[model samples]
Target: MGHPNDDTDKHLRGSLTKQNKKLSRLKCSVHNYDWGIVGNNSQVARLFALNSGSDIDPYKPYAELWIGTHESGPSFVDHGNGRLESLSLKTWISDNPNLVLGERLLRSGAVLSAEKALSIQAHPDKDLAMVLHNSQSSVYRDDNHKPEMALALTEFEALLGFISVKELMDVLCSVPEIVELIGSGNAKQFLLVNEQYRDKNAKAVLQSIFSQLVLSSRNKIGAMISNIKSRLLPEMQKRKLTDKEQLVLRLESQCPADAGVIAAFLLSYVKLNHGEALYLGGNEPHAYICGEYIECMANSDNVVRAGLTSKHRDIQTLLSMLKYTQGFPEILRGVSLNPYTTRYLPPLDEFEIDLSILPQATSVVFPSVPGPSLFLFIKGKGAITAGISENDNVEEGEVLFVPAHTEIRITAESTELHLYRAGVNSRFFTIP
Candidate 1:
């Protein structure tokens, strides 16, 4: 027979053990937005199905797999015993801030295999975000500014920033319907100023054209779209279309008569192959067209959308918020961190991403980071060891939360493993 105090001691010890766990498995959330890829075709669906032990429904759309403490789709800690605690990830972090060191970055994986494009939108800068959140809390969900980076998992296409003045001028000359829509006066002024000054007044000119396109009457936009299709369809059949023309046609088919079809021509068209990435700063306009990617951003959901979505459109706000910088956005191929790892560090203090590809029977040790991180295994099998915790058999689609200053080592088991680690940018903190 044991002492009566033994049970109490065991319970206390158990609670302490749970509290001292520096690495924990996380059960992430999946959003089924209409823009997501449908069924097994979606990487989001595959990951969700793998994590939840649920079968994939062929008709359902699986859009985003969220692995953060965001209020909208908060993740949960998985206790490994098939039971979940009532506290969400956000609540847990709030309750135990010391463990995570008050981290505020959000990480998510996305897939866009649908016909429709994402919204033509720009996120507010910090000051504007605070004002928008305070003035219109219902529309702008959070006060944090969102400067994001998207790392391509597959072939990805997007319209990012404004095209160069020369490219815009060429587009204007080629597409007469755009001239008709923006009015001959504005078009002529844009062409004349660019030809004379050579981009000295590019910002003002781009802003004028974009504002006119967004504010155009729906009937006028529809008529212009019809005329554009009539003119372009014959040309498309005769010869290979330019990337801009192809995008216009694609957007038209996806959301007919939307102002974004015309607005897209003013933006730089970007296509990224696997392992590539692009950074989107605040107030920069962009729209993801298709493919799978892992995205990391500051903790915010505030979007000022102009067009190409069924969601709310803040035309005036979007027009006012744009940077109106004209050029090709830079594509990133992450800097090599080690033989098995690469790091994608954007020019922001909020967040960064590290990708590791480990072959079978290989082991890699990651040094301690300044803040908490969300580590996700997107492919194959692995094992992780951190402090006293050992995930002996981590499978694909598993997410783990690593506490601040906790070093972790991963070993690929029988197959090659692909992992992405999301955390605050290392430059934000000093590593002693």
Candidate 2:
């Protein structure tokens, strides 16, 4: 398959000059992790195949499509001279920070497509991140805190934070295996505290119980898992299982007897329809369980994992770093910037995403923002014009990087265009 942007490159080579080139097409990188959806079944694989003009392997898992300057999976851009992969996006930003990043800092953006559940994990806060990075540089690669948001492109399922104390009590009363694994005495103490305090002491109580659950011996966890499966199998045959029950079975199938299978009951299980979003700040324990979503975070790759992975696990670090907040994660429906654009803004200074749904033959002009923006076109065909640059032809799965202070105009051709624009949060900096 030929590169989709080959003709666009030829047009750019003749028209663009260094002084007027504020927007250029980007070639992003894709990661193939075990949890990813396989081949073209994955949005990541589809987009990557289109952007890179590569043939898909049906057997391969396509996990993440990264569009940023993060060292783990950096993006490249065409410099208008027909060299599509000549310069790294990080190097371009470094060479022109004032023009590219403006007053804002770097951020990481990606599309995550999961087939199976991701690891039960938490990202560290800034202080902990710095300590972890200094102490274990190989694992905690960066010193920046990771505050992230996931905007669902498809039906998404995840476990985020601890469930409310009342909810936890209900699970404990029902799931005897979990109580047994955590020990009958500890479970009784947790139930007593929740019953009396009514969640006022949720953090302390949850921390104690969760610490015990996570610290349980592998043998005990495995035995409890077997007992739960035996109990649930009859229910599965007789009646439809609850979502949490179904999730437990599914996680067990993926990683049989893994501690995450037992630990999952403690966290809030959430299912998001398309366009709904979830925010996970630093020290929040969460796991992405099936589906594809657009994700943006602070530029870091530090994850403290305890279970559901073949990767390195740091149980002590994960237990220490978690916030132990108890509740369901709020699902963001997005605020409308216009009829064509909806913004998913998490409560963080790192990044925010604007989703644009442009109708066919319609044009929308976005005024200059204070920071650089990465535009990912997930659907439809369009032409984008930014600053003094000529219109850049865009199609599904293409990406563009627009520098700071550049007004962008996007015109949808024959179909409605769906794209996500990721940028630094405007609240973080003042335009001077």
TM-score for every candidate vs. truth? Answer: 0.92, 0.92
Q: Judged by lDDT against the true structure, how good is candidate 2?
A: 0.83
For candidate 2, which ten residues in a row score worst on lDDT?
12-21
Candidate 1 lDDT (Cα, 0 to 1): 0.82
lDDT of 1 by residue, 1-432 (tens): 122265654553355356644676777778888888889999999988888778899998888888887666778766536555444566566655666656667433332343247889999999999999999999997788988899999899899999998897897789898777667887777777635575787777678878989999888899989998899889977999888888898899888889999999899999999889999999999999988888888878889999898889999998888889889999999999889999999998888899999999898888887688888888999888886565667778888787787889999995799999888888778645
* Error in Å for residue 238 of model 2: 2.7
Residue 64 deviation, candidate 2, in Å?
0.7
In candidate 2, list every pair of residues with a backbone clash. Answer: none
> In model 2, how many backbone clashes occur?
0
Tens digit of per-residue lDDT, candidate 2, span 147-174 = 8899999999999999987888888798
